[model samples]
Target: AAGAGAAAGAGAAAEDVPEVERESPAKAPVARRRRTVLLAGTAVVAAVAAAALVVNLVPDKGHNDRSGKQSVGTAASESVDSSPDASEPSGAKGRSASPSASRSGSPTASAPASVSASRSREAAAAQGGDGSADGATAPAVAVNPYKWEDPCSQHYLIDQNPEQVPPPPAEPDARGWVNALGGVAGGQQMLALTVQGTGKATVVLEALHVRVVEKSAPLAWNDFEMGVGCGGGVETTSFGVDLDAGRPSLSPKAGQRDFPYKVSESDPEVFYVFADARTHNVSWYLELDWSSGDRHGAVRLDDKGKPFRTSGNVGRPAYTYPLGDTEWGRNESYPDIPG
Candidate 1:
């Protein structure tokens, strides 16, 4: 009986122990897992919020970067538009004026002077001054129409054997003479006259008058060796004719010989006279008279059929007339002589 009672007492003691206390180990692990899960969920939410905040910060930098690029683009466009050295023609006028103000010694110095004058006129106009902008600008000059002359129509019969004529006296004051004899040569006749200007200003060739003189007149004779194979002797006379007066005369003064000839810039004027020898005959004399600036001058052919300036100076030949034979005939018809 006493042993049964002790066992009962021990069983009661075991029952008296708390049920929560008995399951504490397993329940503590479950509670720790739940807390871990909650903590993990909170950490995940913080990471997501941090990523969103970083994304928001990135947009600001991106916006600033885009804005900077746009500003740079705008500046580049402005620089290009206002560039004085731009090649666009539309900007030429503006560029011409600006560079003169900021810089000097450029090739556009002349442009600046003109621009300053235009600006002064504009300022005067703004102040209600009498300067008219339109009047301040020079009017455009009219260009003359280019008309080709028919040299073949001016052909005349001349003595091919000019050596038969008597030579002029040895005295410098004595005049020479010329005579005409009929002859024909089978060859091409091509004449080219080229006039070039080297000055920085425009050259005006006003009143270009040409005339043909007969061989019966007294001319200044000079010994000229013509290398052409026309069977004509080389002894020739150097003479000058007044193209404007349509008369043969002696050479003029050196200063007077350069009259009516102006050269500006580098443009060249070319005149051509081509004729097949089968149809046309060689003429006697070719005289040229022209006016340039305030001067007038005349040119004529020497005895050797070469044109030369009357001044007898040898630097730059203001005018050149080269005559030669053509290997092939031109198909174009010659125009009639002008009235």
Candidate 2:
């Protein structure tokens, strides 16, 4: 019975060890491993979701910022293109627009204002009333009124040797008198005379003589004279001859006489002479003596032919010399005569 009791105690001690306690050690390890795996999976899922969110948010924000910049650029470009005054000279426009663009950082806002300001400045400069140099306006240059007209268009010459003296020879002689005094009075005379050489010069007409000659012999002679009254008069008693001195004078019967006249290289003075011829039936000739400063010269014209011929019809009661045979020559015509 003591042996039965010992077996019973051992059995009781075995019974005190619970079935759950024995399984606890093996199951605890498996449960703890599963819990650790679940926590690690949850952490991995959270990290992936966070990474995706950051990627999406960052791109969207960047895209929005880029879109804003593009919109601003487009608006600025449009404003610059559409502005009315923006077409001004590129340099000026650029300068003006720079300030506005720099201040506003918007192309649309600054370009037009800059262009307008530039235009205003240009307009002010053009008007010349203000915003100009010294407040003085430029003056218009004066033009010559007689530039296109012939100055020596109307004039004539007459033989003025004294009637008492014998007439000159038909052709020029060694004396230089007859040859020197032969030609139409106003024929081919210069409307403006060109004074050449150096220094200031004075143009002076010395004398005039007219005579009726037949075959190189004098028929009638008359010295040119001047009278108080100008224009038409009796041939023998007209202004061609001086009434007081009974001699000829170089001064023109009509026209300006101011001498030592200022002249330019491009423009010169023209001269003319006038006289009366109503008397003789024979062929006639004219003699004109002239001096300019130190230069002395003479011109002659007759009724015969070129380089020495009368232009006006001698038979006519009154005559005025044309410009074809004057001292300047036939090449000179109206308007070609320089100022």
For all candidates in order, the CA lDDT equals 0.35, 0.36
> Root-mean-square deviation of each candidate, in angstroms?
23.6, 30.0
TM-score of 2: 0.20
Model 2 agreement with the true structure over 1-339: per-residue lDDT tens digits: 999999999898888777657799989999999999999999999999999998866766545656766656666755764565533556654444334444446443133223332343355456542323321211111111111112223222345423322332222131243335532322222212222222233334354454333212212222211111235422221123221122324344443343333332233333333332223222344444444433344444332222322233222222222334222122212212121
lDDT of 1 by residue, 77-168 (tens): 55555655543466455544334333432333233223333444455456565233223221111111111122222222123323442322
> Which residue ranges in model 1 land beyond 4 Å of their true spot?
1-188, 207-210, 215-265, 275-282, 301-339
Candidate achieving the largest lDDT: 2
Off by over 4 Å in 2: 1-251, 254-267, 290-297, 301-339
Q: Give the Å error, residue 88, model 1.
A: 47
